[model samples]
Target: MAASAEKLLNLLLRHGSLSRADLAKAMHLSRPAVSGLVDGLIRQGVLRETGCGASNGGKPPIMLEPVAERFGTIGVDIGHETLLRGVLCDASGKQLAVMELPHGNTFESISEQALKLAASLKAAASIPVAGFGVAVAGQVDHAANEIVYCANFPLKNRGLAERLAAGSGLTVRLDNRARAAAQWEYYFGAADNAEDFIFISAERGIGTAIYLDGKLFSGRAGVAGEIRSLLLPSPDGIGLLPVEQAMSEKFLLELSGNCPDTAGLVTAWRRGEPGAVRTVDYLIGGTVYVTGLLTNLLDPALIVLGGRFRDLGPEFARELATRLKVDPPRQLEFRLSKSGRIGAALGAALGVILENCKSNEP
Candidate 1:
């Protein structure tokens, strides 16, 4: 696969289907070169002819698209304390299947459960599984393919990727759940055209994935977006609290006193209960502060909000917008993630697909 061919594949994936002439024009290559790339991709099972496209005047041109059923990848999102979700997707990042299981207590047990789930999905897949992408709620050593530390879960220093690859017989890529979700957004969601943005995941904890200049910025230690480490001044001037401790779902629930879950808290807030109102205000203020900070630093085009906060809908969006005042030169847009609850899992699968696409390039 030449660089031109890879570019063509990416274009087709983004646009669904395109004619050879379209590919040629997009890549600024000659018609013969585009033809050769298309033929090679078709022969390699990476792409297939998808009927014909409407022509301006002459005969309809043949259109090419990714072979959706020829290659696939699996994604597993390990939660901090609840469920383990998985998704199986094709080369084009279309979901084929999804499953969930309760989180296991130990690393070995969790690994076994995840492997079994992946194996089951693989057994049912029509195409070959390219690899597996695991999204964990923790700091990851991408270079070492290891889970360096997970504050909310018990997976420190675990060769989790190695175990998954060995057990499932497929390549594995492990990453922080927020980073994986950001990748998914960049490649397949509303941020497809965006080169710079912030993906904030506010669930049991607050984590972020930063994209700048069309690349995921992992920083020096792969902990660049770990908001839990942020030590902000307390409102009372008594002490400081980590961002995660101050605004996460778990903390909010604690603040609610009687609310056992997010739903209850939401109800209390709607009812304007004093405790619930105070907690909601605090969370909103914290969120606005972080968004403003990021905006000042990165001047991103978009900010994608994910995790539990996603359910807040328009009210949260409006409040956030009112509070955040960007510089005159920067026009920022904010929206809830369309990836839904399975974003991390879907992102993991898409990461594998993207890596596979790159690997196929010559």
Candidate 2:
């Protein structure tokens, strides 16, 4: 069931639709076997048949879509700044329930708070959470299953996965939220159509998720997108600065005097406020400079924008694209992800879903 379903869905996602014959050839299964699985899924209401295709002088083949409300995965995005947003995503990438964790950023405090959120959401999940993926803003050690460091978070020691897993009785894992978002785009967003691209996430922190040769480029060390490169010098000339130093939630707030970093920017940008425009420009500089520095290295074909600032909308994306055009990559496309906040959690869920979908040895 897992292998056939994965092959079928991957085919659907890739080609938009496929007949049972196409699926059988793609999955190396017999037509009868594929039909049985498709029938089962259709009856379960998780796969819907629609449309018609060429029929070689016979009845046209019916197309199908993975139901948007089948199985759900719990995704946790923990901010270094004491905010946590959890979302339940069904098999088709639709968001179900969102559990926001609003608590102080202490390790113990957030852990306890997260446990409660997980417990409540777990009970709420109509079908068990297919898996749990917890993404964080700071350094995370996937192999060790711990958070090495998250300066913005009030938590002293990291690693919240263990506590959440123990409390909820579910398998859990950690990933850098931005990279997770990039993975989501590569799988389901604007980048889905591009062979290579970079996912730049800007909000409180600046992060990158580069995709090359049609795969999310998570480096050997798992820190490919963390551009801490004090490499980006601020025009003010106050001190050597990292790309994030000149552009983050903290920097934006300092620019405006007060307000939640992302939400406030959304409101300000909507009103055409001067301060918002300036800060937005500052953030664009970091993105522009980073692209300039890395273009020679990765030579991405596109760049997709996501994260909290995604709420700022297409205008922000256009502004960045206008500047980026000044020193464009050798060749690259630009897009803003609709996945936005949902990407991180969806990628986390994909981690678990795809894991269970591996084929048995032939």
Candidate 3:
């Protein structure tokens, strides 16, 4: 598992299949070096000879592909409310099994629930389970395998990854839910070809995840995407408001006064109810402002809107684009996340799969 071998395998995984000549050209290595690596991989059962590539008036080259069914990983998303969602995925990121467990309030209870669910998923997986990844709704101290702080659940200072690994007997990785969702989208969702983009997770709170140059741009403290702290002008004419206070589901419901849920507010707005319509308009304005600022600063090629925005439907994206005030040249693509609520969970699984693969490299 030399670095060259790992690169060859990764290229095959990304491109589906490749000939030794293609791998040598991509890795700037000689054919003999790539041939050695490929031979080793084939012997290890990690890769297989798929078929033959069309030749340039020479012997047809053998194409190679990763053995997708040889390895799998478990992903768990710890939600803000009371549900812990889990998924089992192969190395190629295909879902094998999915389950949801009722989450407990305390750290011990939640850890136990996730462990149980993960165990079940591992039992159901057809391939060998490499590890587990947990996506939490707040800050994660990945090195320590702990949740630094999370508003949705009382999990501050909890050694979540360590406990889960100990309980389930697997390697574990943890990350912020928004960041994990961004990873999922970049690898398997709408942003597959995008190297730079912004992911806005408008759930119980407003969270942003930045990707730059094909990497997740986690700032010094990994709090780079906490958009909830972004302060903007308030519609009430009282004072400035934080992005979360102005656009979150709870705040929007409060603004509408009579709506008990997002569905109710959507219904009211559809019926031309003044309060609901006004609140929706205000939220849209705030979103436009935030997106405009981000476009000017980052200039990403795409912006993915997820969580509650998905619940708001297609009209929100259309309105946000129409209302955006960025320069014409800076206009960017906006997409609603196709992964929906399970994105974070899938991302967690992807993370573990990647970690295991990387760790296996020499």
**Tens digit per residue, CA lDDT, model 1, 264-338:** 888888899988888777778888888888889888989898887777666777788777887765678888888
Highest TM-score model number: 1
Candidate numbers, best lDDT first, in rank order: 3, 1, 2
Evaluate residue 210 in candidate 3 and report its C-alpha lDDT on the 0 to 100 scale.
93
- Candidate 2, lDDT over the whole model: 0.71
Q: How many residue pairs clash in all the candidates, one count each? A: 0, 2, 0
Residue pairs with backbone atoms closer than 3 Å in model 2 (clashes)? 80-153, 204-249
- What does each candidate score in C-alpha RMSD? 2.4, 4.0, 2.6
Off by over 4 Å in 3: 21-31, 52-61, 263-273
By TM-score, the candidates rank as 1, 3, 2
Where is model 2 poorest over a 10-residue stretch in terms of lDDT? 353-362
lDDT of 2 by residue, 1-362 (tens): 77677667666654556888888887899999989888876876656887898888888888777665556777777754656677776766656777777768667777787777777777787875767887777667778878776756753344577777887788887777887777777766778678678887765566788877767677877778678655665546566677676666777667754556678876886776877767677766777777656665677777787775466677766766677643443556567786766677667766665544443111
User: Which regions of candidate 1 deviate over 4 angstroms?
Assistant: 54-61, 233-237
lDDT of each: 0.82, 0.71, 0.83
Colliding pairs, model 3: none
